[model samples]
Target: MALASLIMLVPVVLVTSFLSGIFGMAGGLLLLWFLFLVAPASTAIAVHGIIQMVSNGSRAWLSRRYLDLKILAIVSLGLLLAMGCLFAVQYSPNKAIALMVIGLLPLLLWIPASWLTFDASRPSHAFACGLISGALTVMVGSAGPLIDLFFIRTKLDRRVVIATKATIQVVAHFTKVVFYINAALMLDAMGWTTVALCIPAAFLGAWLGKFVLDRMSDLQFRSWTRMIVTCIGFAYFVQGTSAVLSA
Candidate 1:
């Protein structure tokens, strides 16, 4: 079983790296959807966060010269504030909040179409977007789509945008990890092993994504990111409903 489990991770690594290469972010949510049948929801979320934080943090650090510090600061602070608010109800999984966020996720998926434009970098919505991404990411396990929606609207340089988002995501999810660990939602020893196994997949995915970022044009990025975000939202909605039901 252990051998087979390791083998199973092969496809997980491949698919995630491929998608993240073709797109521009972590494929954790997509990988989670594929693995949920074999793992608990919280375990999957924590492992996903841990693996990707290391992976994306490294990607961002190496790609720092391209990052827009001003935009990074704006969004990172909002996510932190959101984390503080999330602290109160962080441990509690009020079906109400999850449901509310889950319900709106679909709606928000379409919002970028109307509210998002290729030429605009809407930082005013950065706080609200980061807030939602921060809150539900820990609670329900996926918030990349929420963050990507506003990002698609922004016209920042692709390297700057992708690397910055990678950095912010790591920071945001790192804080959530502490919350989960404190709330006793973290991984066990074996779970930690599983998470460690996932690390290479995530790192490769981020590296491949940065390579893809170099080749993609702004219009190409906007179009492809929207599609990827839509897929992520759908993945989250399905997995989130399963989490609630399984809980």
Candidate 2:
């Protein structure tokens, strides 16, 4: 890695870790932007996904006490199935996808559109969600929110929900990397450079964010959740569609 890039890793790790705690998927967005500055688009997504796995794994591991096993199982199966179809779930995620979502984010923020919830009671259905999440995850750095939307209505403890999502993300990210490997995109020098820089930032950020969120009221948590996802929608809409169009 270049010296400048190596220096960047420290902040990357801290920032990612911090964001993931409050927003399960926020770190991915931050990491994507950082990596986008340093690498190609596909590489940015793959590397950021890996960064999120590590950042979130730390939080989930520390908070294993709060994990909701049933919920995790349901969502995990769906993520796994989605992973199974990684190559087949392709769509041209160009600037158009990014712009469309960015445009919709304002409306989503105003009315808070309903989440397409998943049926946790049915393993088959859960697996279907997982399958789709996994596949899209390859193109999209994070899909845990889609899975979480499915579970959010269940009224589980907030900690348990967060833990389960983090755990499932770890598994799904790991599986997705295998696809990157098969597609020959694993651990390039720049990728490792990003990892080295991002891991510490992510580690610190995620840990601290979790502690802060733990003390927050449910209303605050819900508000922050919407805020973070809104940011992501704008980010994706700008990124995917713009890049594709520009390409």
Candidate 3:
């Protein structure tokens, strides 16, 4: 990456991390879109994974008291199972497919409550959330909307929702980085350095976001999260569709 591009991205990292810190969803979607502009699909996913892992890790640490360990464990098992299945298939994604998948994910949030029955507090539902979200994360580089579907209908408060999701995302993004480690290794030194600089930016953004989160009501949080992610997803879908048609 050029120094100018790297320099420009630091603030993008900070802002996206801040958004994720607040909503625990939209930031990764936006960050991955920016990365896709700069790197190939595999490399972009790897780097996005690294940045998001740090961002969510910090958020999880900040909200550690609210995390549900049992849910995490069950969801992780499902994530592992999904990873194994993908590895067996030797699956990989091209840029258009990834963007289109990401574009379509936000619609998961739009599913009416009457039509949806998922509750992350249930072990069965949590496992399915992990399995589906994990596969989407690996293939498309973001699964915030899919994961949100399971939790949004639950009775858990906003704090628990954010903290628990952050914890799971830390694991999910780490898995993504490992899955694309070869692509990560292909980056030159400057590219690696650019990634390194984004780490602190991500942390700072997450840290700053917690303050705003504390002030927001539960209704405000959920409402804003859905609105923001939907808008971002629509833009990505259009861009992806245009690219596909041009090809």
Candidate 4:
């Protein structure tokens, strides 16, 4: 990596971590955009996986008491299965498809959870959501919103929701890093030194975010999450549309 790119990574990760920590969303997508600007798609995806793993890990640890183990296990199993499928197929993630999927995932919130046939309370259904989410994460670099959709129906309080989701993401992102590295797709941009410098910044951001989260009411948290997700979706949608138009 160029010296400038490495230098730019710190502030980006710090801000991404704070945003993701506060709302339990959007940080990964922000990092992905920056990585795409500074690196190749594979590098962007791989680095995202690594940084997100650390960021989510910190958040998960901070809120470890509230984690739902059953859901975590079920979703993790699904993520592993999805990883195996990707490995078998030798897939290369499509950038346009990724952008479109990321853009559209938030729209799932507009649909009432009651409209879905499956029970969100069931582990099997959680697994199913995980299957889709895991696959999408590998392609898009951040499917946090999709995971959020699955949890919204469960009606957990804000802290538990954020904690459990962060824990699940730790597993999901780990899978991505392993898969991408094994496939030799992440080789060019695994800058360990750069990553090391960014880790503390990400952790600091998460801490600040948690402080903000503690002060917000459940209603406020949910409202902010939806608004943030919508804005991110529109941004990606525009980027994708522009790419298509130019092509």
lDDT of each: 0.63, 0.64, 0.91, 0.81
The C-alpha local distance difference test score for the whole of candidate 1 amounts to 0.63
- Backbone clash tally (model 4): 0
Q: Which ten residues in a row have the lowest lDDT in candidate 4?
A: 182-191
Off by over 4 Å in 1: 1-7, 94-109, 112-123, 182-188, 235-247
**How many residue pairs of model 1 clash at the backbone?**
0
- lDDT tens string, model 1, 191-247? 556566767766676677666677878888767766665666565566557656787
TM-scores across all candidates? Answer: 0.78, 0.79, 0.98, 0.92
Model 2 lDDT tens row, 1-247: 3467546856776876787787676566566556665555455556666777778888898789988777567767666666666556543333244334333433333343354444544566567767766666665555655555545555666777678778878877776665565322545676566566666666778889888878987667667776776776676666656666677
Better of 2 and 4 by TM-score: 4
Superior candidate under TM-score, 3 versus 4:
3
Query: Candidate 2's C-alpha lDDT?
Result: 0.64
| Worst-scoring 10-residue span by lDDT in model 2 | 101-110
Which runs of model 4 end up more than 4 angstroms from their true locations? 117-120, 182-190
For candidate 3, report its TM-score.
0.98
Model 2 earns a TM-score of 0.79
For candidate 3, lDDT tens digit of each residue in 1-247?
5577777788999999999989998888999999898788999999999999999999999999999999999999888888788888998978997898899888888899998779999999999999998998888898999999998878999999999999999999988899999999998888888889999999999999999999999989988998999999998899899889999
The alpha-carbon deviation from the true structure for residue 166 of candidate 1, after best TM-score superposition, in angstroms, is 0.6
